[model samples]
Target: MHIFLHQFADNAAFNLRRLLCAALLACSVMTGCARYVDKPIDAHASSLLAPLDPQQISADTKAHPSTLLPVLDIDPTGPWNDMQIGLIAVLTNPGLKAARAQGGIAEAQVFAAGLLPDLQIGISADHPDSVGVVNAYGISAGFDIAALLLHSATRAKAKAAAAEVQKNIAWQEWTVANQARLLARRLPFLQQQQALATDAENTAQNLLGLTTQNVDAGNAKLDDLALRRVALLDTTERAHTLARDIETTRLSLNQTLGATPEQRLPFAAKSIARDFSTLDANSLFETARSERLDLRALRDGYQSQQAETRHAILAQYPMPVLTLNRARDTTPIYSKGASVALTLPLWNRNRGAIAVAEATREQLRIEYESRLHETRAEIATQLTELQRIATQSELLRQQLQQMQPEIQALNNAVQRGDVALVTYETARAAHLDKQIAALALAQAAAEGEVTLELTVGVLLWQ
Candidate 1:
């Protein structure tokens, strides 16, 4: 009995030593595993308040090619035209930066998806409470065969998703840049309107003062004095309204450029660089249908959905987990074998997932078609409106020119005391009104140009 007990103790000690070796190896492996470090977020905002120097941006862009869409060779200190301002907005806009960061995560996801999963390892231990029994243990090593089969489709989907994300980010950057361009174009026109309104206001104030003097002397009718006061009020309101619009547009432009609200820019008088009068709307829409970043992103999204659908369909097949194991039991029997755990396509068969994936693909198809139609219609509408503005602007310019001779005649007549001062003032204010209208049309044309560029996803401006 003592001999048997010593033999059992010897077997137990051997098993215990084997278990200790396994534990030591596991510890060694865990030492090479990933460790986490604390990462804290900053409480304060890290917004860049001041703009980068233009020359430095130009230099940097030259040294390391700019990734900006619709890249331009911009002279920063030169005229801040629509394209130049747009480039600036793309460079500095906070929203675009955040979007690009999201795109980076998408790219990283592609890398992760391409990686092969690690082999699974499992260990089991059993202890016997009575004598004539030894310690038992099992060790298994293998992988999910189903995951290996689906890897190609999964990686393709991730790649397509990453491409879609990047294209969408580019589209967003284009939109923000165009917004800044529109406001920059608008600011100058608002300033011009204010100047014209100021001239009219000055003329009306003089006329009102003269009319009041004549009324006090019983030389002017009360109705004429009332007319002069009304004219002065109209001019004053116009000036104030234009001034307010200017300030508002300035603030908006600064915000789009990622600058402080009160920041000032050297706004140029002429904002439009290229003419769309020659380009047919139909032709432009055709080009945009293929070239627009958003549309391209939709195609990429559709491709990714296709991949997802394929993956789901592939999943309907039986998934298998293959493992090879070596074990020793409490009876002192040793074993080694390979086994497979297969998931049968019973009632489920991954039908729900397949259906969902196909439905999602169909939804993306519908969305892309709808967006295409909207894009075409908007291009046509904006182009037609821009043409109308140009026509109106031309007509107004002709009218102003036609009035120039009469205005000169009125000036001479007033100097000779043959025309009333109020009459000359009325003619001057009317000319100013036409000038303001012309400026409005011009500003609308500039803004429309930017919108069209954004819609078409091409730089029409040189």
Candidate 2:
């Protein structure tokens, strides 16, 4: 009886220790650890798997039935258009590749959340300093009662967080895809502008040469020669600007397509224009709510926050540490028993964590609401701007058509030397100005439609 009572004291002391220590000990024993391995970084940029050959790829896919493209449920590979470039961008963007790697961590967290808590087993042995005392041995096992009971909340939180990660990745892909499409759309417009600029520059240069000859021969006014020189300088400036624009846009396109800055992929096709008259504002708002990937990702984040709030509330409950102990002390004392340790702090029952979780949930809700509002406002603004551009472009084209007869007559008069050089120069400058303005408006309407597609989370053109 004395042996059992004395052994109880030793075993009780073991059970008094925090389950946290047992947990650490359990982790160290049940799992093996290793030194860190070296992972070398490759600083060199990697090229894409294949060069984008839109025409050839389209032909091959059709000619060979066995060569099928990936079915991502958003197939844009029908006509070798901008959308095809968008698909390639989503598949190959280097930044997106790095973003996708983060998903693995979320998956691992979910796996860990589902795992059961490990059992902690501890053992001790003692040798008597004096000759009379017998050898002593003690063994104890501990389990975390709270972790086992509250596992469902932890798993739900992890699963929701993983879902949020996946949604965020999808959102990134959507943004990258649209960026590639927009760059492709802009490329053709820049090319058209470049041609106009080059033609204007050449025209000015020729006119200035003729004016200089006429002025030296006393056949034209010196003031007329000065005006021609000014016109040449203006056209030259415009040409230089357009050249830079073309080069910069080309570089941007390469970047969007995940190619090196200098690697120009000669695959951009003319972007088909969308009729803004057919687009309904009400319908666009609905589409944005339902299909916007960022909104969906935000919803996932909010749900994860919901799980976190629940878990935080559950954490307030007392956690019981169950311990089973067996021991043999000096002088024939022995013990075998079990114990349940309830840890409850009256001073604070996880109020701080619960408060933090609630506040965070509210912040996320507000962020999502603000983002939705911005999406709706932006969609409406782009639609209105596109309508205005289409209207002005139509009017300008009609006016330019009406002005064509006079321009042709003026050209005929100049050829026969029946008009002042200044008269034709003025007419030419006005004509060029109107033509460039119309082209700019058309480009704006086309690119605005692309922006609208991004805002509404729908493909507006092929």
Model 1 C-alpha lDDT per residue in residues 131-226, reported as the tens digit of each score: 878767677789889889999999999999999999999889878977887888888889988998999899899989988998999999999999
Output the number of the lDDT-best candidate.
1
Candidate 1 residue-wise lDDT at 136: 70
Query: How would you encode candidate 2's per-residue C-alpha lDDT over 348-458 as one tens digit per residue?
Result: 898999999999999999999999899988988889999988899889999999889999899899899999765676677678778877778877877787788888876
C-alpha lDDT values of all predictions: 0.82, 0.76
Residue 107 error, candidate 1, Å: 0.5
| Top TM-score prediction, candidate number | 1
